[model samples]
Target: MTIPKRMWWQNSSVYQIYPASFKDSNGDGVGDIPGIISELDYIQSIGVDVIWICPMYDSPQVDMGYDVRDYEDVYRPYGTVQDMEVLIEQTHARGMKIILDLVVNHTSDQHKWFLESRSSKNNPKRDWYIWRPARYVDGQRKPPNNWIGNFGGSCWEWDEHTQEYYLHLFCPEQPDLNWENSATRQAIYDSAMEFWLQRGVDGFRVDTVNMYSKGDMVDAPITDPKSEWQFAGFQYCNGPRMHEFLSEMNQVLQKYDAMTVGECPHTPDMAKVLKYVSRKEKQLNMVFQFDVVDIGQGPYKFQTTPFNWGLPQFKHAIETTQNLIRGNDGWTTVFLENHDQSRSVSRFTSDAPQHRVAGGKLLSLMMSALSGTMFIYQGQELGMVNFPMEWSMDEYKDVDSSNYYKMVADRSHNDPKEMHVAKTSLQHLARDHARVPMSWSDAPNAGFSAAKPWMRALDDAAICNAKQQQSDKSSVLSFWKRMLQLRKQYSDLFVFGEFDLLDKSNLEVFTFTKTWQNKKALVVLNFTAEEQKLVYPTEVRSQKSELLVSTLDTPASDKLAAYEGRIFMLES
Candidate 1:
């Protein structure tokens, strides 16, 4: 048998840092590049090879830095461009690569390009953005189309100066850039991507990569009769020119041998996803698929409806995803929690006080054993969980969460019962759950800042903080350290192995096997609070197997403890 060669990214792990909540220096209550530089050693200790920092470019921070005002300059709150250059230098000095968030699909309304584009109808840069005339119905002016934005309201925002409406798929402050123009595409490559690569940046985590090409400007079908605006993903996501533009961007990435992972939402088709990441396509190394995190999301915007999901459904989502990218060339990203998602321990498994540790360990084992590049969001290693349900709407600072709350309040006319229900659902599904400050220690502000943090820390930071867990041998932090070490020790099996999910119908357990050459390993996870005995396959019952790792301290046994996970190496 011939062994296949793997790239640096395929064999490595990525750590995502939402800079604003990571760590704060200068007592500013906001995390900055200098603070990130101070914590490089700590991040290196987790055995991650790449650091994917969210956008720190000049921005109005309307979407927490996703709205880029200047691709070349660092955000004022994050520090200066020199600080970013030092970050790239320090990261490379440690033998680790750093990637920045690329948000070229749109730019902040305050960006010079946008300012010029919206300045006048005959401006040379007018074609840089998507602009259309307003539609007048019954002597009343409405938006160009009935498409709804991701942040709520009509996608078209009227510009008084130009007397035309501009399309913003997200917040109105983030005006979508028109990719149909050759000048726009070239400008993004020169000013956004190559400029960073020249500054020693390794790669990028492209934001909304698939939304670059918008389909025909038309009204979306009204899925809900109650509302006039409709979801526009079908018309805007994964559109006609997506692959063409990605391939063009890939040409720039290829020059520096840079790694690229794209954020592709609303693209549920595996075939379409394969085109974005397949080795033959050469557009992106991998793309984030949201099927798993989106398991319980409702059809409406922001998932305001009640959250309902189970282990079986979750397993099915994973199984389907794992099987689709089975070929040597096709690859995917393995992640449970991110800046846009709630904590995995709280969402996928039990976050009850007694089971939180075990739940965290189980998820760690699952993600480590999966067949892809694993991404660990900051604070995830400490088993950090979501804020308590008692938190009021005022405590939530995420724009999406706030927008959803106001939408629900307006529709229900501020009925106390309706508002209460919305709050309860947001408790489980809001993006703010993941945006809380990282818990570094039990100190005030969770050791994230000397001053009051921009947002509150998790209530249990006293127990879940990294400093508290660092000294304890049995802590989630220690387990994560050990688990990542184990993955590196068996990279051939975990990184290059073939994945096969076993017992697909089982609700309380998730079982799978990874095989590479003559080696085979089995991973069993009990997803419930109660202990359960696993039934092995007939072919494996007689095979000699050695226990490799387990969430529980007890010796290997037939029964699994609550939320327990175990891995074993079976003889080939």
Candidate 2:
């Protein structure tokens, strides 16, 4: 078998930071570039090679910072462009690369291009956005189609000035750009991409990349009969011309030798994903697929009740994704937590006070042993969990969470029982759970800010803060550092080795092996709350093994403790 050539990204691990909740330098209750600069040494200590910062562009904060009003400038609260320059320089000086969030799939309605497009029907920039006349049904004007926005409500927003409706996959304030227009594509390349490359910025984490080339604007098939609108992901996600546009964009990235990881949602077909990352396609270096994270979700993320799922299903998702690039040149990303998803510990394992540390270490061991680039989100190293269930709806600040709650209330005609059910689901699944302020120390506001934070800090910050963990050798944060270091030390065995699944029928334990030539490593993980028997494969039972790391205080002989994970090096 011909092993794929190793690249810098393949062997590197990434640390993702959501700037708003990371730290606050100016005490405005918001994290800024200078705040990130102060923690550079701390991030380096975790042994990450790249830092991926979420969008901080000038915006109205309609969808956090996803709505970009100015591609060339930084948000005033996030410091100036010069501060960004200093961040880039400092990160590189420390031998770590920095990648910015690229959100060109849409622009804020307040952006110059969108403003010009909405000025008049005959404006030159009118073709820059997707606009269509309203459909009159039964003597009443309606949106162009029966499509639902990702957040909620109609996807088409009526514009009073142009007398036409424009499409917004997310919110009305953020309008989708017309990728069919060559001029629009060129402008994004020059302004959003090349501008940063010229400033020594590494690359980007492209947002909703596959949604750039949309199909025909026909009404989506009604999957939920009770709903008025339907999800139009089939019409826009992984559209027909996605590769063509991505290949064109790759031409620009190639000039600077920059790396890219596209965010492709609603994509279940691994073959289609390969086209985006395969070296033969010349598109992107890797892509973030949503299969593993979407396990318990229903048709929509904010369901009244979560779908039933277990470790077996979760393992299948991971194995399927990992095997996608086994013999191919394509690559994938391994991540359990991000800005859009809830905390992995609370969702995947028992998050009780007794099991939280072991649960966090289990996840680190599993992900670090997998094949591909691993990404660690902020606060994950400290085993941060979801917000307390007692938090009221007013405490949840994400736009999606609030919109979903309102939709449920409207549909149920203000039923108090229905409202309570929605709140329960939001407590478990809302994106706001991940947006809580990082616990820096036990100080007021968790040391996130001198003033009140934009969002509440975790209730357990006193125990989960970084300052407390950094001093404790047995803390979850310390385990993460050791696991990352092990991955680097055994790069050939962990990063370039072929993965093989073992005991696929086991429901409580996740067992796998990574083999590179004569070197073999066995990984065992217990996913339940109770102790389980450790049944090793017969072939390796007699072989001498060296213990690399274990979540438990002592290595298990016959039974594994709750959430225990162990990695052993076997002599072939």
Candidate 3:
């Protein structure tokens, strides 16, 4: 298999491995890099071309590894930097690329940079992070701004040592880095990008990439007044100087042909998405746009303001992304699940338990069939559902979720009787749900580790375990394997195809067409439980185009069962 020079990521299928829960080699009850090495065969067997490992940086675990205490060394629990080197060697040996999580937007408050910055107001490196006196307005005492932290409190933390408030968009312990300072940005670039590229990482999934280079203006009036915090997330995401900082990063990473994909929110901005991926680019190859993921509800955290945006809305979002990126012949990275998201199978399959598989495949077709780099977060291939009521509060580990439970229900009129229901919904949306270990074996702990797993293992592991699915003729895993192989089989369909939207009227189903040169693929997916009929548009006349993949029996035999999805080659 000769690898195409131009198709480095276009030919790749990235599998994200959250190190803390992937697998545990030692009996210490936490997953480590050695555990990841032990599972290479399983990952390679699934046809993964890229392994995007989450941050394993030495940290206080305040916000997991998002808060880095040491940018150059691995946490002792996960393993040493030498262990990461071994993982990289093994991955490349298996013909796979590795993307290290880039969490440069912020650092642990305990980091030496912050330690010096807080040592004194006039410390030599005092300007390395956002610092301000306790804010005052009209002679009234106040915090620096009205911005609320993503994890639930004031975004500013008062540093008693320095008598100043420091900015922290996330948790207080994870202070936002002052990217405005040239030296600070350059130094961070040298440590995170320069060191890793030299050590042999293929790329990075920049954490909160848009959140770096935040707005320079301070204490602006709340743009989104309805937001509980009153300020929009834009205050810290993709603000002024963002491109400048990215360009600086691009200069360094490009020296090693290292790729980057930013987890950008609302980022496929018409022509904006192409800017980074331009053949004459500044930084990054692609970004994970969030509009599609946040489609259904106004705020996924709040159930009261449910907007009821369904497949129609989600389909439209995907189509818009395809059209926007295709216009520039640019790149895009598509994802259905990640460390922070509700599973697609559950999101799209509302009523039918049986149709969930079809629903999952349907989402896959609509997204993957479009021209872009594709990423399948762990367990997404298995159509994994969210943890149900069995989940106790202690099993969860997400600041966003813990906050959602406290501030919303504990203080407001969101219905306390449905505390468990609310908790379950929030739990489903929590990163920990997807963070559950992949069901490799049906052993007592799903064989993720000999020790007790981080999050509770899914209870029905016997039926959904990977060992059973691998041996069984019919399984979500089988469907995914076939789909991946087919993507490799029809390279153009998976890469350079042009996407055309069809029948926006069908709210219950998602439909689209992919055509490259003369080849065509029609993808239709049913998202609901009802036995609905889809009247095909005249342009898409491919009833017998040979179903390449399906989640249910052919509709010709009966009404398309709930959750039925199919990808087909259009008949000329």
Candidate 4:
């Protein structure tokens, strides 16, 4: 375990805003930069030091904003370049930092580079993207390999005009860049520097950072015989030159006074992660791993199985990651919710009306007290739950969810029971679960827009929203504020402390401690909705404990109420 040196990001709290769902300002039923600007004060009031807005670059919205058509310009619907400039300035003025999404791994087919690459074989940009000749099999043309896209279906998309297949790890419209070419790498790196460095934007949250390079395009040995996607996924992720490419990008990032956190998924190994985020390696400052986040995934990573999980499994994942990164010069980000996953309150905690707030607080305290930077997704502070499971299939907007539904229906031969189970999985794990509009008020469109919202507002917006929570002292929002305040007050103990897992085999509660120098903080969390006692070891039971913070107003003797979490400063 490597201890991380003091850095700006280590002390900062990040709030991720899915731009389209955050707020729609122009009455176009879409959120924009101006809309984000309007909520700057509210974001600042929430105590997050940094705002990580999802990709807002010029795009056709094929994969939302991840499929970038123009790297230097902003999406017209969201705003113009000048609007982004103003937003940055406004964010700085309010003493908060803002980071844009860096999506260089792929570009929309409509992008000039892709268009030129596919225009003709001899075009100067032909080598800018991955393209291969079709392999004839049994007198029929087929893609060169069996690789599958992360979204669904084959990874290869045939281009009739060019008579070749261009690779896309995601949607067909989003083509992966050919990073093996020096010129292609140089162009992407230069564009990133010109756009953010000149505008004085804080940094970036790199999208699909690990898949820039690819291995030999051959059929992967099937590990999970039942899941072809899983077999192909092994070949498409964490390519051979990932480290070389990231190190080169870091060389450029190091010249600027900024930070970067790569969105590295499917990386279950610590060494693979440390290679990129280690300060000694000069790559990224941190990365978002999916060990705990992908807990209930089915055969393949994207396939969502039933929500069957336990405290022991959850504790092991978190503890193993913490132990691996501890003092190893590698840094990781702690989060329970993000744009690609369901809300924590809904998926990980008891969202029952009576226990919702406490459950949210328990999750929040567990996240904040972990030995890494804390990322809070929008509406999470308000204890937002998932969209009601009753919403028909038509109400969902995400391409991923729709694709998964079709795949499952086909596999199950349209069996009503199987389709119902698939729909339930979508309700619990779909990316859209976190894509609902930000609930700002009880007013129409949840005060997100005077016009109709692009998506329907949560039915319970009136009960759970920023307006209601900001006014209530015991709201999840308020508790989050206190957590951040304490984090700041005890930076040495919380941000730079050594983490040690306690009662590793405990099945009822998750317990751990963070110690720095002579100070120690013990955190105990009841994983279930029923009261449980923390079985403290003899050494800790003998020591004096001072309550620092808790999810419950009053402790019930030695028993912890459902979803209750407590932090006690130990007197050694």
Highest lDDT among the candidates is held by which one?
2
Each candidate's clash count: 0, 0, 3, 8
* Superposed model 2: Cα runs more than 4 Å off: 1-4, 304-307, 538-544
Question: Candidates' TM-scores?
Answer: 0.98, 0.98, 0.93, 0.97
TM-score of 1: 0.98
- List candidate 1 stretches off by more than 4 Å: 1-4, 301-307
lDDT of 2 by residue, 201-278 (tens): 888999998999888888999987888889989788988888999999999998988889999888888899998999
Q: Give the TM-score of candidate 3.
A: 0.93
Cα lDDT of model 4 by residue, 1-572, tens digit: 34445788888999999989998988998999899999999999989999998988899998898999989988898999898889889999998998888999899999999999999999999999999999898999888877768887778899999899999989999999999999999999888555676788788888888888788878766665555443565566688988889888887877776889888876776888888888888889998888788887776544555558777888887876666567677777888889998888888887779888998899888888887888899999999988888999887899998888888788889999989888888888888878889999999888888888888888888888899899899999999999889888988888778888888777778899999888999999998888897667665887789899888777776899999999999999
RMSD of 2: 1.3
Clashing pairs in 2: none
lDDT of each: 0.89, 0.90, 0.76, 0.85
Weakest 10 consecutive residues, lDDT, candidate 4? 222-231
Better of 1 and 3 by lDDT: 1
Q: What lDDT does model 4 reach? A: 0.85
